[model samples]
Target: MDIKKITLFGRKDVKVYSDRPKNIQSILSNHLENLKDKEAIVTEEKTLTYLELDYYSSSIAAYLQKKCDVKKGDRIATIIGNRYHFPLLVFACAKLGAIMVPMNVKLSAEEMEYIINHSKIKVLVSEEKFISKVEDIRRRSTHVIPEEKNVFVIDGKNTFNKLIEPDYPLDSVTVDELDPAYILYTSGTTGRPKGAVITHINVIHSLINYQKIFQTHEDLKTLIAVPMFHVTGLVAQLLHLIYVGGTVYSMERYQNKKYIEYILKYKINFLFNVPTIFIMMSTEEEFKNSHFDFVKKVAFGGSPIYQQTFQMLKESFPNAELHNAYGATETTSPATLMPIKYPKSKVNSVGKPVPVADIKVVKENGEECRVNEIGELFIKGPMVIKEYWNNPEANEKNFTDGYWHSGDIGFMDEDGFVYVRDRKKDMINRGGEKIFSIEVEDVLKSHELITEAAVIGVPDEIYGERVKAFVVGRKLSESSIQKIKEHCQRHLAKYKIPEFFEVVDQLPRNASGKILKNKLKEIGRK
Candidate 1:
């Protein structure tokens, strides 16, 4: 079967180029030269043409070069959200070979300070909403810069508009393919967040993989509701859209009902979000009435999607194809993607390994596991990051044998489909029986009243660790807990059943929609 033809909407015989250009500017130049008048990006009330995007990016690049003395490989941090200026800011950094460090909006001042200081960012481009956080950190953090003047707010009193005038452009600086393009910080749920140093070649390979696996079209209008700080938002959403001359519509944040409204309003061809957002939207009564007539495809990534939630999304948006993806910040976004066509079997699988990325299930000792055997998932290819920024320890532990250890437990079927089990660190051990949190969570979610659920191991003097679940809802009762356990018993081993259940109003989650298992565990312990 032709993967390109199956995934992409256009020509099947188009040559797939594995060799990436030296710099990201080359990609921008090519797209600008080819699709000058095309709409490259669209925000709430702004539309940016390809030519305009090129000029603005070049202008920002010039400003960085002259004002901040930023050179190739210099780290510039951005504490912003999804908007028309987001992609332009990223391209500006890329054009000058400056690494763009994206700050997570969901993180507190301390988390932001850690990333900014650890990455050694010289200039910070932030939005007004996060200015206080930056200021707070600047005042107290000894590691970060003490002066607030070092930070430049986007569309604020001290904005990039002053640095770059209208129609101002500069000579494009050339960059090597291996030069670092961005420093994307992954949530340090296990430890301090590590900044993955993604290169131009890494992004180029990721774009190619998205085009091949999703069959994106040049005229496609992608809805980029995901935050640009994420690998999915950067490589898969914005960069890919620009590379293919497609249009991207940005959102400040993901709101289930509002997201559906945006889709209907924009008639978006491509929709990118996480499973949680989709799950909420799929169940929303308002979404059932909305017309998704123009939405050709919906792509979800960042975490595992429950099977029932997938089915619910499919039922709600029957006109559009629902696609699942798997990857991390170190993988330059999407390493694997489910095809647009609905899978006839194992609907929860994250599809197959994308064209440029190779994935394998390996044992703890680094040996490849057989099909259907659960093990650590390792991804290898051009899309994988070369190293972590100033993180020697992380580089040693995560990158080995030319594969990035995903720290995710999963398996591959005979047909090459990947099934994510859970995070290696999130696994709960009660006595000798191993319980995957996702298994318990999925079972709990199957209930009609439960909105969200997370299973974590809490301290137990007798069992080493005891299985405990935190649910999100007030409708839950003792019968509901028993039903959840009974459901888990049917699908999982006896050891996997939760010994304790606590029904809360909600489960603590990070900004990217990932359940904060450590936070849940802390609560359980308390």
Candidate 2:
């Protein structure tokens, strides 16, 4: 509970939680002493206690160390989606002081191969379903681990069986809090993904930030529906619970029905997910009929929660506290969090900086912006990753001073709350007027008939670019389009309103529910 100013990772005067665990292993060890017998993980296949998870990971870690020659600071990659085995491998990596790179399951073989070669992954664990992609990568290139020896499968028979034989003792390894424990690749929506090297110091500060904001305890049980590849799933849901000695429930995939069933079946008390998941769930009859009064906390990010979805969640779980979180992989999952009380007046804001986070908004010309003036956000904190893995070009371009330039464009309110406008790349320029896509989309969503909205700029000869909007709602008719234009006219400026409107069933999204703007531009081209 002590805040201290100390030198960390060559940086002086950085804020950190004094007396924090020296490494990830130490934090797990402290929890194991009192919570060894408590339920640690619950999955569709089986439930594991803290003692069992520890035991299993020890045997697995010993196998990797003894057989694969995995030592401190080696990179271990997992392609198992969101199963129990994912967390099993996480603990296994933690025990060995190894860095984990949880591969994105939705990527093509070529994309996956790029990561394998880039990270130089020494060991790989994959699910039976995704083995073919691994085989393709193996056949196409010699840059990855061999299938006959170093590669292990989760639900298939292979050398993976030796990992659970119960004879290998997990030995201790000395690891510093500043040592890299994770390398999460960026979303790569723009180009090739770059890996963010996160240290144990980064992870510890992030865990403490969540703890201070949420006041989590050993009794807390949260369900994870997101993939482990993301910081939201790995650091926010899994590692945070491990640090608090709390229970975690895993969903191998996100399904609305299964989501309703799991929360009711497990008596889950906490929920963390993107806004799209909550929006999709609200439409189901099972969700509408359910009583989730037992849930105490709900946190959502990736996008702001709209008014309708926010109201639905409030009415469903009257006792729950809904908090908005704003973060990225480079920031160890949270840069800003909604205040503990979640004041309704600031519902649209992402809220204030986490205790350790220091943010500065800057203009395109690189000067600091005045309060309430929109610009890009640069974040500096002990929780922020020191640098990207193996990419000095990106490192030089993305960081300034000690802060990581979070390409997201937004502004800080007079009250210190942060409001994320949109990605800098998504902003539309018409003649000399600039329009943030989110501002236009937010106005469109305000219409009672519009369920969702996305905006993009299409090439135009007159203004260089023009606004286009994609809306989802009741089957579109000519009258509906006219009505939408009228609604937009009342709220948005003439320059900001879309020149084109396309009614679609749904917006394209990645596995994490982030809208794919690149795909939308392609559609706009046609």
Candidate 3:
């Protein structure tokens, strides 16, 4: 449990602060008391100090307790986005010991209803844009609302601000570190979204992991372009900034040009997002002309980074350190991180295990794999969630002994750097030879005419499955396809080379920018 045992490359023996706040409320209170006047949150609309954030959240908690009868362990579902009100509601629920369920704003009415009813959410809050979807769900959802007042909108007449009691005193609610704080739903590509129950201790430990990995200091300013519903935005960026008493500038949504504008406007020092955002930014003309001198560190995750994009980022931000972080929603945010001073030799690796977590690659027989051998990755630590919400089958299947069986296929080098290959189900088998789709996609991305690439296995009568690549780049021509095939043949083995090539304007992605292979399979069928 001693986090200081994990050493970095440059700093051999790094000491991480072990003492942490018991719950989210305590973390917020500490910042409020010590950094009251410091700028806590910034948006295009307004700015809030720590003192104001505490007061607003406390007042909202008091109102929810008195009016809606919200109590400890009650579920409050929010369908809001990256606005200041989103965090206000999150902190309010944390203060009252209620579990916050941040639903994805892009989900359909049926999808929203499934999560709402399954979580048994007592209160529902949504933005105006999504109010119609909430109404649709309320008409058919199994979870009944006692009254219309239980539902609050962010911009409509029944807004969250109207419920705020400015002078009302919030009753103190006792919260344990082990208590459930929030339940974040997975992308649910395979089936219905399973909610991952994250505890207060898990979040605090994750904050410590980020702090040690990023070497956080005071006055650190970050621009949050990712959605708040994601662990990367909530735990890694927003909450971590608050834990360090730093400033955060949140965007309602991500636009490549606007993201650059905010970076300069806020003088952002830290940047964290998925690889797609960075790739889009690097391709923009404004990004090439803008100055990124204020950016000190750039961290990305949720998917593998192509070598071409990595080099683009390195050249774009010469002063900043580019880090490729690796984790899932089950592990809070990050389990392994490539350090700022990482070597070029291990550039493809996701670095070593973080200070608070441990990782191992294991075979189907449950035996640990040797160096450079591909196997399923398993993560263990205080930061790892113990189970899914109300999903006993998933808990039984995914959790073994104290480790969560991450469904990712990867390997570790002799130097302890982890290299993620592909998802367990994403691996393609042609005849007896196994092929990782990511390897082919990475090679395709390196091609001069290719902007993005996705490789999937299509059903083949002889080989069971054959490699097919979907690319977004120059117009497809006989010569262009031949050129790409030639490039793949040079880099990959004969069997690993894609047998079919399809040119598309774009690849389908989930909210986190991960390529949806399921959708690609549907395309293959057509």
Instruction: Return the TM-score for each candidate structure.
Output: 0.91, 0.97, 0.95
Which residue pairs in model 1 clash with each other?
7-214, 7-215, 8-215
- Model 2, 1-526: lDDT tens digits are 8887776656567778887888877767787778889999989888889988888888899988888889999899888777778788888888899999888998888998988889988888887788899889878896575546778887767556777677766667888888999898887877899999999999989998888898888888999998878999888899999899999999888999999899999899989999889888887899988899999988899876777777878898899888889999999999998877856888889889998778999999999999999899999889989889999999999988777899999999888999998888998999989898988887888887788899999999999899999998875655698889988889989999898999999999987788999899999999
- Please say which candidate is ahead in lDDT: 2 or 3: 2
lDDT of each: 0.78, 0.87, 0.85
Which residue runs does candidate 3 get wrong by more than 4 Å? 1-18, 474-479
Query: How far does residue 447 in candidate 3 sit from its true spot (Å)?
Result: 0.6
CA RMSD (A), model 3: 3.8
Q: Pick the candidate with the highest lDDT.
A: 2
Instruction: Point to the candidate with the largest TM-score.
Output: 2
- Give the C-alpha miss distance for residue 418 in model 2, angstroms: 1.1
Report the lDDT tens digits of candidate 3 across residue range 1-526: 3544433212223333367779987878887667999988897777889998888888989988888899999999999888988878878999999999999899999888888888888888889999888778668853554357788888767567766757567899999987999999997888988999998878888888788778886668998888989999999899999988899899998888898888887788899988999988877788898878777888989988889888988888878888889988898988898876777999888878887677889998999999999899998777788589999999889877668899999999988899999999989999979899989999999898888999999999999999999988855555699999999889999999998998898889877677888999999978
> Which runs in model 1 stand beyond 4 Å of their true positions?
1-16, 19-22, 141-143, 146-150, 166-169, 341-343, 477-479, 486-492
Which residue pairs does candidate 3 place in steric collision?
none
